[model samples]
Target: MIEKAEGTFESVMRAVRGVTRAVAAQVDDLVQRPDVLVVEFGVELSAQAGAVVTAAGASAQLKISLTWNK
Candidate 1:
């Protein structure tokens, strides 16, 4: 399972990219074994702060959870 894959980036898009990469890595690891059946995948994005000044200053957090039935 993957959890708390959080990152601060220059923009929300970048942050999402980071989280996506993290999740993909985890999924790739699971799929490599050939016997794992990935049953569920979940992602949670935390609420953004109200006062985002600029794209260069934006931040985001992500949580990823994965469940497999072996």
Candidate 2:
């Protein structure tokens, strides 16, 4: 049970890291300068361990505010 929980946690962390890297790459590739602000980043995870099942999942969202400087 503990091993499964650890695996799930590691998977979640890797997903978070990948998302962060992708977001940063997108920002770096922008050719036009725009005022951008990250308003919120959130992650929620839940797990259920039962006699016959072990399930885990996560939901995440990111909100950003952008203004055109032109």
Candidate 3:
């Protein structure tokens, strides 16, 4: 159906936009809709060579929603 195709196109567009934003942004915290808030964060932690390492130097954040919304 045409509606299904339109929906798919919109979904693809939204995903592309999200990817573009994630790449072009450092900190992304915004409200997705009236009842939903999407916060995407990426961080990099660099530890001194002599210090203990808790994580890798690079991190990639993904889209996540809080439990309260559910």
Query: Candidates 2 and 3: which is better by TM-score?
Result: 2
Residue pairs whose backbone atoms clash in candidate 3: none
Residue-level lDDT tens digits of model 3 in 1-70: 4564455556556765787676445333533332444656454445457544432243455665533443
Better of 1 and 2 by TM-score: 2
Report the lDDT of model 3 for residue 8: 50
| Residue lDDT tens for model 1, 1-70 | 0222223323445655666777677677874444342333233344346532331232334455554546
What TM-score fits each model? Answer: 0.38, 0.59, 0.36
Return the top candidate by lDDT.
2
As a TM-score, model 2 comes out at 0.59
Clashes of 2: 0
Compared with the true structure, all predictions reach lDDT values of 0.45, 0.68, 0.51
Ranking by lDDT: 2, 3, 1
Show pairs that collide, candidate 1. none
Evaluated at residue 38, the lDDT of candidate 2 is 55
Q: Name the lDDT of candidate 1.
A: 0.45
**Residue-by-residue lDDT tens digits, candidate 2, 1-59:** 77776776687778777877887777778887567645456877676665311465678
Which 10 consecutive residues of model 1 have the lowest summed lDDT?
Answer: 1-10
